[model samples]
Target: MRASPPPSSSLGSSCQSSQCQTEGNCMTDLGSIRILYMEDDPGLARLVQKRLKRAGYFVDIAEDGEQGVEQYQAGDYGVLIVDQNMPIYSGLQVLEILSQTGELPPTIMLTGTGSEETAVEAMKLGASDYVVKDAAGGFLDLLPPVIERILKQYRIVEERQRAEEALRESEARFRAVAQTAVDAIISMDSRGRMIFWNHGAGDIFGYDETDVLGRPFTMLLDATCHEKNDPPMSFFEVHGEARMDRGIESLGLRRDGTSVPIELSISNWETISGVFYTVIVRDISERKESEAKLARMAHTDALTGTFNRHYLVGLLEREFQRAKRYNHPIGFLMIDVNRFKQINDQYGHTIGDDVLVAISHELVETLRESDIVVRYGGDEFLIILPETNGETEIARDRLVAAMAASGRFVGLVDFPVTLSIGCAHWDPQDPRTIDRILNDADEEMYKAKRANHEQEGSRAQAPPTFA
Candidate 1:
């Protein structure tokens, strides 16, 4: 219930010095700041209410401690004034109840003359100050100043709390953003020790945060990969260096000691502790593999999987130039399968394709890695060998034996197929241009084919054979 209203003793919007009985005791404006007063005595509660209301503060009076606690919780009050003695709950009990909810507002205890000890106990329960009651009402004037001082202190505390809460939210947002990145995000301390590691780091480097944190940042790097180049991590090891950059390719070491190609970026920032670095690493292994595949496709024969004519021209040109400069001999062997058209016509195109694949595989296995086999055209191939001077006859003979040694379906055919090869060997001093030499080899291949056909002699042409 509301406390009794005061008798008709009032002041202006603010208390004048003469009205307060003490010099320079004027009330400042209390804008929208409410007050809660708990005083069981009817006369005193009304007196305090009227005086504060006239001094421009909206005041709500609770006649008992229980009612005071309820009104304190229900209202947005700036200050609480509770008397020590009450009907149900004492001033200390009210303060204790409010403290359980959260930090209480600026509260002052009204104590009787010898109850200074109890006031101190109330302060421990979160009361800001205590006022001693007197028979003459001399303590009434002290209320305004005590309330003002406590509210000032309360404002300062609230601002600091707001700033701290804002900082915590900002950090939470940053951690969220770091965790969502697809690439690995790492944070290092001034000593280059990892302090923060995101989930992406775990996925890429095959390591957990527990396994990574407190480890040196350099542990993830392959030192051997950067020996010829300057190390990127060195700038932060010292106090000052402009080592921050957006990107660079580096080899990242995994937990299994395998190397992974990664595009990495690191930047340094200053904090109170010293310098820190943020490193972002992306695994580019798939991208590198794709680029290599594209390069191969651009220069490879799709059906036979041998080097195409385009690659052959480039290789021939480069090799010819090198042979001229180094004064070495380069050899070209042109080979064709005899009766290939008859095989495709007799055995269908599917078996023809398989035969072509098989032939290319055999040629690849027989040739040295340095020798390139080109699918010059259908049923024909060109072999380019560098620094293999005067080895054309030997190389051709080796190939013929490899093809003829094995038992193959060629024996079942009416006419067995064979490979006819033409060899051209040239020295740097030879007058023939590389193109002319290639043309001569092509001509020689037809001559060799006719010679083989004459030896095989008269029969319906057999199905084509790669033997």
Candidate 2:
């Protein structure tokens, strides 16, 4: 057989590298394109090694079918290209053994004689593809892309499995946080049945988590509790839209059939299985009472239990954003107590503070519920009116008339208290940041003060109002 002349070893890219066998094959980096070549001919094995390596594959050569099977048992090779005739065991016998295990790598059978019967026999023995020795070039060309594609698919499958494992770990972390949370974390099915309730839920609701699981969330509500008639749906029905941030309140019934206030934030989501809702509930009994105290503290001037300057600035920011988004107009009115320092110097700081508080009460009683009145500074206050028009002068006139009718300034001991008005409408397109808007309002307040001084020939309280 003249050793087949080793198939031209020096053919450059057409053949594998000279040092490839001893140098370790370069194709190992191609990710799953490892190949096992089995033949009794040493020269043929070397030739095959060179060719396959050049084609970007990791190749290991064995002289016998026995050695080939041994190499396959080791990890990380993907395709086996076998010579039909080999020492000790024939290629057919190797294929039979591999088939029995049902874990065989895909194989390309090689026959030296190019007999159709031999090729057919190889196929029956589980050969994935086959080639004759003289015409092996064609096989080599088709071989790589086929094996490459198979390896690519295998890699994708492995990656997906890895990703799934990572998702499982992430979900476990979330569950741990939910279990340890101080506020109750509850999840419900699309039908409003409670599916998940944390330990906090049981502690706060006075029900065992097990007893509540699978029950309708409405079961927690007391039938005799005073109900809100604003919406036709029961609180549970309203809660379905809660996750959409429709509103932040939800009413919860206690285990003892008593109504307890709850502040709820909800979220809607879907998983591989189906749709679900998650609700975070905080018992607001303590919070409401605390808020009431804070409201009284906030509404009262701090010096006199009336609204503070902080309230004015906060309301302006809120109203500005709201008016900008909805294209509604907002009005701002700034009020300053006139020449009260003389009264303070004579009547003392206690009376000065009382004068500030008394003025705030008059402002509060003078404005509508929809209006927000805030103390701007020492002896100064601001009011905000929502849903005003492009021109808020009529609204300004109403506030001025109300202040005059309240007779707040008539009983002043030293100087008469008066308000100077400057009003501007919010432009939706050029709506300013809260600081900028307040600065503009403050500037207008100064202008109004100057105007009042110019008109009355004396310093008078000026409440500048903007829309």
Best by lDDT: 1
* Model 2 per-residue lDDT tens digits across residues 1-467: 00000111111122245654355433224423567888898887887777777776678887899988887776445677889898877888988887776545557788878888877877787666676777435655555665554444444444566678798898788779998998888888876678888887876788988898887766755454335342222454555566645546556787886777887777868778666778787888888889888887875665755566657656566777787788887766666665667678878887787677667777677667787777667766667778866545675577567766666545545455556655655666764666676667777767876666665664334443332
Q: lDDT for each of the candidates?
A: 0.77, 0.67
Score candidate 1 by TM-score against the native: 0.67
Position 126, candidate 1: lDDT: 81
Q: Give stretches of model 2 more than 4 Å off.
A: 1-33, 37-51, 63-66, 69-141, 189-195, 206-247, 254-258, 270-275, 289-467
Distance from true location, Cα of 30 in model 1, Å:
4.5
Note the residue pairs that clash in candidate 1. 343-464
Which candidate has the top score in TM-score? 1
**lDDT by residue (tens digit), candidate 1, 1-467:** 11111111211133444644464444433645678899999989999888777766788899998998888778777678998889999888888888887666678889885576897688788887888888888777878788877665555455566677798899789789989989999999887789999988888888999998887777787776544344445634432332345477778889888888888777878879988888888999999899999989988999899999988878888998998999999888899988788888988777667677777877788878888899999989999888888887788877777766534435334544468888888888999977899998998888888877765676535422221
Model 1 weakest lDDT span, ten residues long: 2-11
Superposed by TM-score, candidate 1 places the C-alpha of residue 168 at a distance from the truth, in angstroms, of 5.0
